[model samples]
Target: MSATRTGGRNGERPVDPEPLPHPVVDNHCHLDIAPYAAPDEPVPVAQALARSAAVGVPRIVQIGCDLPGARWARETANEFDAIVAGVALHPNEAPRLDAAGRLDEALAEIADLATDPRVRAVGETGLDTFRTGPEGREAQERSFRRHIELAQDLDKTLVIHDRDAHADVLRLIDETGAPNRWVMHCFSGDAEFAAACLERGAYLSFAGTVTFKNAQPLRDALLAAPADRILVETDAPYLTPEPHRGRPNASYLVPLTVRAMAAVRGADLAELCRAIDANTETAFGGTWGA
Candidate 1:
């Protein structure tokens, strides 16, 4: 029950990241950075992998932020029987403006990273307007489009991150005429945005944040979403659900979110579990623990 910690950035030994006692699917986590150190510090990848398996997350997709993270995501996933990989250049991780000339090349590197067999999805890519201005927004969009195209080309599921820019995100999805079968991970949009994404045939993923009492509006949106299109994730080492709200989040904590989902949709926990388990498999193209 000790908190995990990692070597500073790339060289420190991370804290113990043991798994938990619930059936869970960690749809998204930066395996290379699972909160081992202080809030802003990086968690050692090894601990993250071990912790994921220890918890009963039947399947997990560890995402990468850059080239090295890409390699590690694949290698670590390949090593673990239950872990899978998702590679993408996170919006803020993309190179800065002056060096933005390398953005396309950087994103291409990520797409190439997805070519690995263990890589079942293509992002954590999308807009992050909450923190970025116009220029950064433009860069995020450029990178996001490529991620979508890569997923389409590889026939892999797209993992989208739509924060406050839901409208623009929808516009881009329409413009790309991107194929259906993507996942809107950690869906924070309102009922309207949920409708827009559902219209595009994109799958919706719910996280622990939806369990908060103040998140009833979010629950309302979840209620509006089609059950088949719904999925669940720990999004851990972040967004831990109620009861464990302030605790360090992990895949094991997903059942709480699952329970919350059940409460929101008025379904039984077992049925809710089955629904999301199926949705998780579909989101990853039926590639579970393989």
Candidate 2:
């Protein structure tokens, strides 16, 4: 879904940060959600790719939050050599579809779209108590379980989105059993919570939020996470990194987050980049694009 930014720096696009010493994949991004682009204009996919590639982020996993988005993700992945697709009804979306009595129909379409070769993951799924309330919890959990099974059955990576529902997310994973490969996208957990997820064999994908001033806990998680289990993402048009916090984000800005992550973990920049690059391949069930 496209996120609307209001006031001040939100309207400004930040200048690109220095390129990374080594390339890495943006494991999660909504290239289709172009809040900074002109109305009715689809996100400038080619331009975005070029900008990101120029900054050492040469590949991206385009995530689809709904049926329309799922189809677009598959089509975009097919058109671009530097992109792969992750298709699913987002956590908030599930409750809405269920309320409309169309959840099953939408999920069936996601399953079909997921079968496409360019679609490498079944995700952006899980729980979101922050946006969804008790009235929707059952539908949300049900959808999360189905997506988990779909990923396992299709042998695709599972990319989970947990927002203010950490325990329940872990509970569902424990109940359903995780897929061979799974990621905690935009991981918003403390070091202790991070250990819990890591114990489940999850790859914790950190985003620009890790660079926020109030995100010391997130940084602690990054520091505690093992090198091979860490991944990076932009979640673009959303979690733009520091010095550019309120601006519209794109994959080109990944270096800022990766640099902050390296500093947090007190690790060598290029080595951390190399590990994240390799971890993404393992987490996502192999490499795609350039």
Candidate 3:
């Protein structure tokens, strides 16, 4: 994927900040897509991983929203001790696959990938009303439900991507009986919705968007979320946090968002980092060890 599609639209990667006092995992990132890299070239996975580790973000859950990406993720995880994988057919991709009558085949591939030990989660899957219209919703929902079942049956964590379809996303999860471990990835919900998801034992993973000035509601939700249930991600090279809002983001830039979240919740930065670290391990089952 081009850097622009991965969050490198500005063609400028933000300078790395000082490392955090405690180690933390970037629960969600796309090292393969290299959003925080040059326009045509991905930031090499080794480079991204090293840069992140230098700054105290030692581990990452590499998400692959399609088959090729899933393959990349699995191979990458197997090759690198610092990374784990999550595989799924994205909600937006579902309708297109269904239209081409290939959704089932694609899903079968995802199911097979889900069983791989290095692939700890099934995700970047859920509803996306912002992009897909009513015409594509049925396929999206069908895909989401299937992924949920796959996650449950395989006993892998379910990583969700809800965008402008909060109510329906919650409804479906409730209707299907959510997997034992699930995450609201790049969580974009209010306190009420946070409470709802927390009630279902979902971990809320906040991304750089939480640092936007207008995202106080997100900050409020962060405050509302229990300490042990919170995790942080770059979701890079997108949602770059404040001070670098429009620039390319990377896992190394996670401290900016973590600091913002700490301030919002009136908590000590190191304590929050430790909590998120533990929360991430719990959410994904364990760290990716060589």
Tens digits of per-residue lDDT, candidate 3, 1-290, equal 32324444565777888889899999888876755446567888888889989989988899989877888888888888889999999899999999999999999999998889999999989999999999999999999999999999998999999999999999999999999899999999989989999999899999999988788788889999989999999887778888988888889999888998989999999999999999998899865572
Candidate 1 runs further than 4 Å off? 1-22, 36-56, 95-100
The estimated TM-scores of all candidates read: 0.85, 0.95, 0.96
Q: Look at candidate 1 and tell me the lDDT of residue 19.
A: 34
- Candidate 2 yields a Cα-based lDDT of 0.90
Model 1's TM-score against the true structure:
0.85
RMSD from true fold, candidate 1:
4.8
* Model 3 misplacement above 4 A: 1-8
Worst ten in a row by lDDT for model 1:
1-10
Residue 256, candidate 2: alpha-carbon lDDT: 94
Error of 3 at 153 (Å): 0.4
Better of 2 and 3 by TM-score: 3
lDDT of each: 0.73, 0.90, 0.89
Q: Where does candidate 2 stray beyond 4 Å? A: 1-10, 37-39
- Give the winner by lDDT: 2
